[model samples]
Target chain A: MLDNMSLSRHISGQFNAELESIRTHVLAMGGLVEQQLTDALKAMHKQDVDLARRVIKDDHKVNAMEVAIDEACTRIIAKRQPTASDLRLVIAIIKTITDLERIGDVAESIAKVALENFTNKQYNLLVSLEALGQHAARMLHEVLDAFARMDVKAAIRVYQEDDRIDREYEAIIRQLMTYMMEDPRSIPNVLQVMWSARSIERVGDRCQNICEYIIYFVKGKDIRHTSPQEMEIFMDNNR
Target chain B: MLDNMSLSRHISGQFNAELESIRTHVLAMGGLVEQQLTDALKAMHKQDVDLARRVIKDDHKVNAMEVAIDEACTRIIAKRQPTASDLRLVIAIIKTITDLERIGDVAESIAKVALENFTNKQYNLLVSLEALGQHAARMLHEVLDAFARMDVKAAIRVYQEDDRIDREYEAIIRQLMTYMMEDPRSIPNVLQVMWSARSIERVGDRCQNICEYIIYFVKGKDIRHTSPQEMEIFMDNNR
Candidate 1:
């Protein structure tokens, strides 16, 4: 019986090691995806088709990472029968990876848009778009940080920061409308830029989703669809 | 030993039953969200503010259902450590519910835009938009059908139909651009309508996601980001 107990402990340790590996792999994948978005936006702003194509090429790596992460998650779930917080952590990792994979797709979408509109004349839309991209990239980074640290406070901060992105998105839309009204010649490229902004706005929303998962992992609470004020209060009480 | 064996069997049975319940709950939620999208479109085309408000109100139910399904998933994952296909089913349900919930939000967004533009007297943009909505609503319905039936063939139908939505979406954008150019008075309402079209187009894309998930579940293949010809081979081989 003592030998059996030792063997069971050894197996449990193996699972724990695998979980840690999964976490590391996911963060690495997140870093790659975040870089994809940054480079895509920079490509668009600088009108660099080569950089845009590079981002597009990098998407396959993101896709491969997603599949690997997913397989690792499934293996962990099947092999380890983890319970409670351990189970939630694995499941959250699975869900968060899905969001990250989709964010990578958004980056690819932005890159594709940039590629299509590369021949068009430059415009001021990139300024607001760069701001939005920067804000969203920061949110993703913070969420990943929160996950790494299990810092609910940092996750909450990411949640609160989403409003900045929303406001910036709205401002860009308004600015695009005015530009389109003044010069119809800018309509095609302006519309592409608007769609790209919308895509990045969605990227920000997905970041908030990652934050939500972190909160779930930390507190076992379902803060989704709850108001920001209520979330703040809940976070305070839980913390 | 007999009791232990029976207990293990009972737990396994409970796991299977809970998974069935999760699937049923997701289907019900999908039905409600699909209706919300359809009615939101109908409300916009017919200028039915009451119907639009109803869609908005129904959003609360969709949100509640999402929470309920998520809770169910978490409980199952926590209590019963399912294996293999069962694990995939649970994970797919979780991811699919996220997509379904987001679809509900898109429906709500469409309803909000519809309600806000209700005061405008202009109605000319409704022609192509109505067509776009019909196509999108049909695509969503078919995609869900593909999901429920696990019909890889039917899922491929979604990708084939997407080009139709794209064509209609582009046509509507072009028509709206001409309308805005010809008369500034129609700009605001037409823009709102354009926004609605864009939302519907995105809803179609989400339907594509559902189909892709179905393929993954049924055929054990990741069809995402793959070429159409490759997907056809996947469906052909898997079917």
Candidate 2:
């Protein structure tokens, strides 16, 4: 019953055809999330409330994509009963889509932060935040690329990139803290930036999550909660 | 070939048996997560570093439970190839366990906040946090009960409770903001408390997620992103 040729054919045939289509859909959605992140950052840097609102409004489409993709995966599992690697692929897509949707959420949060620029102050912090935003966006794009290719090493690269993001985020937070301590009047504005920075850190975490799911799907290992250095070790040993 | 009686027996017998076992497992995991939250709050309120450390240590077990349940779901999908409501139950369990694990993570975050009790200041905020923690604890317990019974109305009740938690969280944030503005020296401690409160707010979010999944499982409707008032209207019409 476990015919190798038949199994191979099954993988490349109908089940994978559907899987491939879902994969394409997920990648397309990932492209949308990246654009949302970029646009949200642009909105903040330029104080474009209209673009911020657009980012918030576009999140519904991202949310809808998740539901649709999840339904397709469920249908595939019920119908095709994909096993082992194929099953992992489907599950990874499901998990990654959740992260992608959350990325969209983080973008919306940043957009709201953009709307809070009542004083139009702190160009330095805004530039720093833009740098953080660009880094997060690029990391997200890479991780999505890794997922689309099932690239384990690329996933690890994204995993390693998170530490840099974390450091940059904390530095921004420290600067914001100094701002708040010096001028109590800027507390509300600084608080919004701090919250937005927190959201970007969450984006890094989500990107890390997507990377972890990729390795899990490809290698069947759970590397979550591992330190970046330990992740390197684990990947080395597992690979 | 499509024998109704056999299919009926199949639904109520072996498949249901496996389903019951997984449900029990999930509930056991929920109980552990609830204990983790309570212990973390105790650690913070009473300044029990040892207990906080224990909470952090216990998260590994929660993570293990998530992996085990996910594997079981994958096995059931691969072997039983469950359809319709049965399939939705497994998928929802998979989704719910991720939220449960994240709740565990939040508890760990709170425990770490307790460990930050170096100068031992902010007793009032700590007490307020305990009240918020207790409310979140009760909400978590009720949501799990709703989940176990697949009670959509009970789940909706829990969903509605998160708004109260959010309001409480915002009020606390405002109080903390004033503290930071008045006593600049307390910024570090205040920042830790703010982070901890954010984690607790996220716990509320994760609980709301679990409730939504329960309703989705029982009623097969997506009420996420809908306003609470709109949710009530949708539930009444859909129910």
Candidate 3:
């Protein structure tokens, strides 16, 4: 017969494996979302209807992954009744996937904008949007990396990066407004471009949210809505 | 000395009380969010800067409630180890509060728009926006009521209501674009109005998300991303 300690260890080992599996699934989902955002941005820049349609179609895959991962997390909670850090990990995963799924929605919307016709003059706005999209995509990638490592410091860094994305978004909006004024005929198309830019900027905010989840998981403290200085102070004191 | 049955009953009763308390708290948070949206709309329509500021300031209360409710849910999971339907209730509450918190953010952003200077011509757009805002607010209030009752049918009705909000949003966007084209000088103010309308419309989507959570809790099925026809069939067959 197994000794009491060995049996307990075996159960814990199994639980650890389960947790690791879910974490792996989350990363896989994140990778797919990142790929979607990248391709959506590319499709917009290149005006590739085929690529845009593919992004829109593949959104269902992202949704399925979210539902699957969410179910897995719920099952783990019911079965393992994880406490403390383990429980936080599960909760964080649940919230992270919700954000990731929404990011996938944003990608699909951006792709839809790509299918709309843009005049030659409106092309400049797309270039600015491409820059903002790339930045948001990079933030997403880094935030996911932080999530993978459960790195609070890295999460904080990603959270700070969102400000630059916001600035870029504002600049693009100003440019779009100017374009609309110069050529009122371009208003409809510029408006579409504006909406696309807004969606891409929201991706940055979503990444910041993921960063907050990472910090909550690691630090066991909710830092949401806290100012940057406060977050830094909390980190320093906790360290 | 208590019998086994009595002891189990006592423990279950206490667990039920705890769940009830958290559910009440969720409703309270929902009420606050609804109030915030209503006040934000009123402020925008009446151009009440003081009221708008109040809404912005009161947002922290919503954030605090979310953090507190989230912590309580986590604590219950650790302490009670609730299973089956009890577990689903807790998970649903967790997800619902997240959506509620986001709706609260939407309210704050809308209030901020109220503080912006709008030309006389832009006032008409605000009237259209007020109609959309009222529709979204009603949807939020009704969804919260359905949540309180755990009424799947009511939830589904609110889910259907979101289509109307989307159409209203599209209509407002078209109007705003025309205004921008006609009076390029009004572009800046019109754009602000456009953003506010978009945010208010998102409140409807958030309510729809809450409706999905209610169904998930009641029916124990994940129906996200499913077509309305599929949802109806699932509800019908399950009934």
Candidate 4:
């Protein structure tokens, strides 16, 4: 018969494997979402309706991945009954996938803007939007990297990056407003661009949310709704 | 010593009490969020800056409640190690609080719109927005009622209500676009109104999400991302 120690070790090993599998799956989902965002941005820049439509079609894949990962996490919780850091990791994964799924939705929405007709001047307005989308995509990429490493420092850096994304979004909004005022006839098209910009801006916020989940998983602190100064002080004091 | 049956019953009783407490707290949080949405709508219609400011300030209370309830749920999961339906309930509460917190944020943002100076014409535009906000608030109220009852049929009904909310939102958008095209100088103010309308529309989506959570808790099905027809058929077949 197996000894108690051996049996416990075997169970622990199996639990760790389960956790590792979900982690890998989450990173894979993140990569797919990032690809969606990047492809959607390309579709907008190139006016590739086919690519945009593909992005929309692929969103179901992202949603499927979320549901799958969520089930795995739930199973782990029910079977392993993880406590302390282990439990926090499962909870964070659950929340993080929700945010990733939302980013995919945002990407799909941005791609829809590509299907709308735009004059050349209006297409010019998309240049700023492309810049903003690129910024958000980079944030998503770096945040996923931070997530993979579970690096609190890297998460904080990505969290701070949202401010730059916000500034870029504000600049685009101002430009769109000016464009609308200059040629009132372009209001409809410009409004579409504005909505796309708004959607991209939300991606930054969603990425920041994922970063908070990373920190929460690592530090076991719920750092959401905290001001930047407060977060910094908490990190400094804890470190 | 107590028998195994009595000891198990004792533990189950305590677990039930813990679950019940969190459920009560969630309903309380839902009530606060509903109040915030209603007051924000009132603030917009009446141009009441003080009420808007109060809504913004009171948002932190909503955030604090979410954190507290989340901590409690995490503790229950760690201690009780709830299985099956119990596990789903805890998980649903975790996701539900996140959605409720977001609705609070939407309320806060809409209230900020009241702080902006609006011309009489812009104020007239807010009448349609008021109608939309009221519709969203009702959905929220009914969804919370569904959540409290754990009624899948009620949840499905509330989920269906979101389509009407979407239609109302689209109509408001069309009105705003026409108004903006007529008076280009009103672009900035109209954009703010448009954003407020968008935020209120999101509350409908968030409520629908809560309804999904309620159904998931009761039926153990993940109904997210499903079309209305698919959802209806699933409900009918399950019934």
> Which ranges in model 3 have alpha carbons more than 4 Å from their true place?
A1-12, A235-239, B1-12, B235-239
Error (Å) of candidate 4 at residue B197 is: 0.4
Q: Which ten residues in a row have the lowest lDDT in candidate 2 chain B?
A: B1-10
Candidate 2 Cα outliers beyond 4 Å, as residue runs: A1-12, A225-230, A237-239, B1-12, B118-121, B226-230
Model 1: clashing residue pairs? none
Better lDDT candidate (3, 4): 4
lDDT of 1 by residue, A1-239 (tens): 22223223434567878987898899999999989988988887777899999999999999889889888888888888887777778878988988999899998988887777433344567666888888888888888887777777788888878888999899888887877777665666777787888889988889888888887876778789886688768878754
Q: What is the TM-score of chain A in candidate 1?
A: 0.90
Comparing 1 and 2 on lDDT, the stronger one: 2
- Can you give the TM-score per candidate against the true fold? 0.90, 0.92, 0.94, 0.94
What is model 1's DockQ versus the real complex?
0.48
User: Cα deviation of A68 in candidate 4 (Å)?
Assistant: 0.5
Give every collision pair in model 4: none
User: What would the per-residue lDDT of candidate 4 be over residues B1-239, giving only the tens digit for each residue?
Assistant: 11222223434577888988898999999999999999999998999999999999999999999999999999999999988878988999999999999999999998999988888877898877877898999999999998887877778888888899999999889989999899899999999999999999999999999988987887778988877798779879644
Q: Which docking class does model 4 fall in?
A: medium
Tens-digit lDDT track for model 2 on B1-239?
11223224435677678877787899999999999999999999989989999999889999989888888888887778788777878888999999999999999999988887546457667877887889899999999998877777777788879899999999999999998899887777788898888888888899999988887776666667666688779768644
Q: What share of the true interface contacts does candidate 4 keep?
A: 0.65
State the DockQ, from 0 to 1, for candidate 3: 0.76
Chain A vs. native, model 4, TM-score: 0.93
Model 3, A148-225: lDDT tens digits are 777777887888898999999999888888878888988888888888989999999899999888878777789988
**A14: Cα error in model 3, Å:** 1.3
Predicted candidate 1, C-alpha RMSD: 5.7
Model 1 Cα lDDT, one tens digit per residue, B1-239: 22223223434565667776787798899899889999988887777889989999889899899988988987887688777666766777777888898889888887787676444346657656788888888888888877666676788888678888888899889987777776655656777787778988888888888887876766556677776687667757654
